[model samples]
Target: MLRRGNEGKKPLKEKIILHYDILFKSHGDDSFDTPTFWEEFFLLKAHPDYIEKKFESFVAKDLIQMKDRLNFLFEKCLEYIQCDQPVRVINALQTMSCLFRGIHSVEVGDHGFDKINLLVGFDMAETSMQVLLRCLTAGLTNDHYNTTIKAVILQLLLVIATGTDNISQNTFVEYLMTNEELYDTLLELLTDPVARSRLGNDTVLLLALMVNYRKYEGVNPFVMRLSVLDDELALSCLGSVISSAFASFNKQFVSKQEESKSSGLFSTITNMVGSMFIGDSDEQKQMIKSNEAILLALYEAIHLNRNFISVLTHSHTDATLVGTPPHTPGGTDDESVPSQPATPTPESFVDASTTRNVLSTFLQYTSVVMQDTKLKRNISSTKLCFIILTCITEDQFANSFIHDENMSFQVCIHKMPMRHRKVKAIVEKPGAPLACWLLDLTVEFIVSHMMKDLPFSQHMRCLGIIHRLMCHEKKCQIRLSYNWRELWTALINLIKFILSNESAIFGRWKKGIFALFTLVINIFNMFITFGDTFLPTPTSYDELYYEIIRLHQVFHSLENFVLRHNANPEYKDVSSRLASSMVNVLAIVRHFNPKIEQYMKDNNMASLTEEEVLEIVKSNYDDLTLKLQHSLDHFERYSERPKETHFFTELVRSISEQYRKTMVFDNIDLQDFMHF
Candidate 1:
């Protein structure tokens, strides 16, 4: 029994030290069967003050002895796990986890540098790897273990798999991948009906990490085995996880009008499942094809939760009554009034009320679902949305689901609210403001998918979604009504973010630049077409001026980047086309706002002569050429064999090819537009 209150406080530190000393002294020879001593030691070690202040020094003084003792304890723990003694097993696992956590903390120098030299000399990685493999093997082969024990084992494995030391992590991955039995066991556990409800999300997450590891380290034999795993089996496994996640989410949050924080579990499962299909390997393609059930599950889950159609059609009856035909024009009021109720006509089917409801519900659902799944707030939601978007855009079968007359995409759009009041309360209410969700979702999609350096075709598919949304007149009008400047700022900042991060635009800078240019042009066109109707007030005019200045700066930044890279023959044509596009846009800007033209002149942009621009371009070209030649000389002198051309060289070649096929000059020809 522990002492209480002030009596315990005075001697607490002394008591902890005494406990530690006795445990070490008793187990000094690396042999101990005293459970009481071990339990006392575990409790003392787990105290926050002891762990934070004294654990490292205690372990450091006799490092060899401590390691050997830990090794013995770990072996004992494994034995305990196999004996079906739940209490002992849990305590043992917890003790081992804590020890490993301490060891990792010390090894990584996370505890500070007072004992780095002593900690570094120990081979903790080798011991950790051995223990990790043994635990994994035991967990796999043991059938008597219940879900609680299995969850503990899985959690321990996660800790070991994500070890701080690279050597141990690599060794663990190698072991897991090389052992076919282990792989099969993990798959079985993931799909097991009883275990999946409790551990499916975590299991899929581990597999995702495994997949990522394999991708990063280059081809592995394990990946081939995974690919060849029966496609139907893989799909069924993934579908089970997704279904369980959705069921859990629905159970918790289905009745609430506002979303609950607990929905993260469902998001996690969907994200993991989606991540499993991110690559374009034939195996992945086949797995995706077989997993249509997952998509259907998500659709049904969303449909049941939101009931978009009912929400959309709720006000339809009221709308139809108000839209009744007016009394005959020339008749007196008494005579004009119909004897019977106004008869329905073909025109009534397309009444203002129906159109309003449809559009409202559509916008509402789109915003709400997007907010729910945005990557910034939830990776699972992001992945789920990506999967849904990809399927709708790329797969015919999934496309048909959305476009089916019975489940019309238009109906989905119509379910959303048209007025800001309805949308403002629900969309992103807990996170960002409602007005920013769409922009946030767009940026999240790009960053999550594109920044991974996936194929250009995949990037194009993502961009296509944004393009479709921006081009829709109704969507644009709705967005403008609900704080358009906020949306506009988000887009501008997104472009700037891409420009600043080389990885985001890697190997596809031309297309990225072209996309930004097109976005700016589109925004300008919106302003030109809608003008004060969208602007609404004087504050909007001020915001518009600021936006124009930002656009001018972005244009200059792109031009400079192009000029700096134009020395290469591959970039010359793209550079020229981009420059031409910039010029065309500038001409339109001058027409759209005379005040902006004067601002440009004050900033010396108006005074930038063609000769000066050429001079800047030529200087950049000379500097880049010199640098390239010097790099080539150094490589030739130092390298024994010829070095293959750099990836950037291939990137440039690809961009050149893409530019020729997709580049459009003077595409935005706003030359004919009269000034607003």
Candidate 2:
């Protein structure tokens, strides 16, 4: 057996000599033991240089001394990989995978250029390219190898493509460009559902990394390949990546620590260390980080691949005509006159299951992010989610998904200040349309960040989404007519909250505030246009009228702020849009002037003129600010409190007791220890 750090008590030089001698002898033996060979290969793969683990010599000198031996081992590994023995090939692939990982590590660290030359001296990049091509040609197509072997071969190629330095990656890409068969086979293997399902996340991640690499220059091969990918295949890949991302979040969010069955102190310490290391392992952290890369791949595909978007927007087509008669209009059936077939009516559609699945996943992910304090800081994923929404919703058919009524989204918003303050949960009803849930979540997300003094461009994107939805009168009518109360309340409160806080108002805030008013006015104008259809009942008429009056009052309050910044060239564009939207509202009010006068008189609700409305807002501004501060502080109470863990406290106390027994402390140290 190969030894690490001279476990068998042999001299370092002697051990190195014996290690090579044994490997060569094993290669010669016809009855080769695969597991034994793997164990020995693993030792060499783990520490290629003899002195790396022991740190007995300077790293550069050790690498220089071991260069020839390392070269010999690589040659042997290549030989084994090309041989007829399947098990031996698999082991060799694993060794190469580990070696490439080490190369990537060297490339990532400081002084990587020099060390990379030493690790993979001359022509190693070319050899890696050849190996990848050979494996793809033989293993991917041959029935001799099972799924596991094919997976290992794919993994080896992935490691070479991703983990190696620029030279190795460029070499592989050049090979792919020239070798059409290899490139085609690789794509076929990746797109195969059976293979992908068996291959798991590594396969998905490898595809994502390859696609995502186009952000760099000289990625024409990948870009060209992405363009040629079948639309269904690309959509499938995107759906898989999104589902994987959601699963990553769900795994962390849904998991809870289990109660320990043992109570011994040693067991406790062991479990604590295991939890610190194994539970929250590097693998878990890597999985979490991969979500960004995966989402980026989806983003790049949506942006770069036109076929992907086409498939996403229109999933399938119906080729048959709806009503093609057996004969011409003037001919009898017995005559059987031949007529040209009616053109197929193509209706825009997407996979409803896929769309619903995506919406539901986002709902759950956003809910978890809001409810879990630990997850609130994950803004990158959240922003990515919104940007993806913005990109897909640009299409009218896709935008109409917000009004999908087949599935309902429900999530519980937890109250902040759990211990001291009593706050009721915001329980969403099960029957509300999906649009209502999305709007509520978006508003809450904006407010949550505003409270934390963190504003982002995604907030603008959120507003743009709502604005786009309102641009279509049919969408606006549905949003208003169904669950009108909640929708109106959310929009009004958001506008009021923004107006109340002048301290947090910046350039973006000005744009956001005006843009919000523009959206509200457009909705108001549409409500009046469709009032007969939307407000058939008298009570509905009263509700909408009251809301319009309240909104008019709000518009009065915002008039001065708009005028103050009207000519500020910075907000000139949004200010003009707001002005035009308000004009539409004025036209609507002009048409209904007599009804407005009679309604106010009948309800005894005096009309507040612009001047009076502004005065009232000024007087109530302080109270509005106070209420906003209270809400922010209420959440802060939960976040600001120090988290107390009994196990951690006891563990620290135990460590302190042991330290105190071993080392006598002076008064200063003793006092500090006591406090700790």
Candidate 3:
């Protein structure tokens, strides 16, 4: 026999080894009976040449023991995050490059997730992120790697951590801050739109991690306290912060979504950047020494910096800053669609408009709690404690992140009518008003995202939201002069549908019923409004018409939401009266035009043929649904089922019956009250 000198393998491409190693480690200690998506994912498709040498002998089924495989696969990532390895900076890029081309499903899969969290979690290893920082700075400057290569590498790291959350709070970011190279490398990615485009959920999570991670100057952990005057750096940093925030939504949170209970991260970025606009107000009538040109450049930079624009425009930002960022031109483009838009845009921008539209639509089902019933019952029955708690907690959480507490508190009050005037309440003082008001807003957001498909969908959540808000703050309603009873009643009404997954109170589709139903009802917790006024009995035909109205209301609501949240006061017109009017008109329309609906169905118009309708619905749904699509709801502690919402039930039942029976006046008789 020949000498056995050739059997041993030579030094392999670092990435190839990394790919195999990560896959091997991620495979875990489990077994697979059949072929797994693992090999077809990381190695075989990624480095087919290397597969023959390393994994060729391993059966595809053998790849199932994910922990072992993944441990080997992501060993590099684990090492890099902990700042371990021969050349962590180089290895980090190599690991990322390999991950970019390979399937990211490993990290997203059940077993893969556990491994990554364990590896990348706080202090998984001893190495520092400083190496990664150096690697990035040096990598970008090298002629060998272009922007695309950098993108691929960066995206790869992102792929590994897609839905795994709180990744920002880890120490990896802290280590990187001490290392200028990596931080600068990230800055480049944030500043360059072309490069940032490649960053998706993974990038978002990484940025979140970076923002929350401690920055090291000498010995202490650092914060991203940005200055308004530092436009060049601020612009890109702002973009990165926004990108990171929005990216948090980019993951496929099919099961339970991981939401930050504490608005800590969201508040951090918003308030820090918000300091720039500290004095640009009508009431205060103050402006920093910074001149006009600087403002103009800031506007252009934010606009050109797509990531920043999308982030700052998200619903999480303070409502005052929601509109166009101070000096931007022509306001937000996404805020222009009216309801039933027929055409919808892609979900590249999860801006403020998207969030507002979602919330506004959900509020339609709200009923007046009746000055009679608010807080009338016990702790559980009243659901007051829960509502108050959510608000107080949200305010506390958001405030903790605000560097200038007074400014944030001012904004919290500004959302109210003459909020600055300040009134006394349970929590005490002007700042307390914001906490109360914020609870209202938060509950409003929850109700806005209700759905009929999930049974007592919106109804359950609405009650839950309200209850949470009322938990710690009892006198919150004192802040609003309007009839809070009706509003609270409406919330209970929405919650009813969420609790019971009955037939869509609106209607069911004739074709692709399941899929369409999922898209319309299950996929989205959209609101439903019926009749111009009064109630309709539940009937099949009525259900269909009601569904149409629901679609319409949702559309208008979305359009308004976008405008309202975008800092455009125009969208905030959906007052209780306005909502009531729309409901009345919808009822009358259903009462009179039930026949047209049948005719449209005969002519195929019943299917909502207009692409714009789908667009608006999808866009609005995407905006809010993204939050739900993640399992954020799971984190919320539901206290108890809300009191019966006769108002919502009566109204929904009224539409169902009237439309089914081809009767109208009961739902909307225009003789006494003019038709809307």
Better of 1 and 3 by lDDT: 1
Worst lDDT run of 10 residues, candidate 1, spans 627-636
Residue-level lDDT of model 1, residues 1-676, one tens digit each, is 9756684455445654565454445244432457765544433323323432334565444554554555555555555554444445554555455454455445433432222223222355345445556666576446555555566676666544443433224333554555556566667775555456445665654554444343434675544555455545444545445543333232222223233224567634634444311213343233232222233333322222232222222223223322233332112232222333368665433334333222223233333333322222222333334434433323323222222234322221111222211222223232221123333445444443323343333334344444443333222232333345655565555556555664556465555555454444445444533444435464564455446444656655666666775676866776665555455335433443454445457776855443443333333322221111111101011111123123213322322232222312121111211111
**Which of the predicted structures, 1 or 3, would earn the higher TM-score when compared with the native?**
1
Candidate 3 has its poorest 10 consecutive residues by lDDT at 363-372
Cα error, candidate 3, residue 504 (Å): 24
- Give the per-residue lDDT of model 2 (tens digit) for 1-676: 8556756784555543355344333134432235565445533322233322222322445445555444555666676777775545665666555454444443233544444444455657456556657766677655555455666677666655554323223333344454455555555554554444444445554455454332244555665777677757646645554554554454344332222223357635654443312124444444444455455555556655655654433221111111222322112222222233355332222222333344445455554444322332235455556666566555555555556565454443322222323333234455544566666666556444444242435556666555555444243454333545555655655656666675576444657667656755555555544544534354554455455455665655556567777899988888876776565444433334445566568768788564443333334323221111111101111110133233223322332222222221111111211211
Worst 10 residues of 2 by lDDT: 626-635
Better of 1 and 2 by TM-score: 2
lDDT of each structure? 0.41, 0.48, 0.32
Clashes of each: 14, 0, 121
TM-score of each: 0.44, 0.61, 0.29
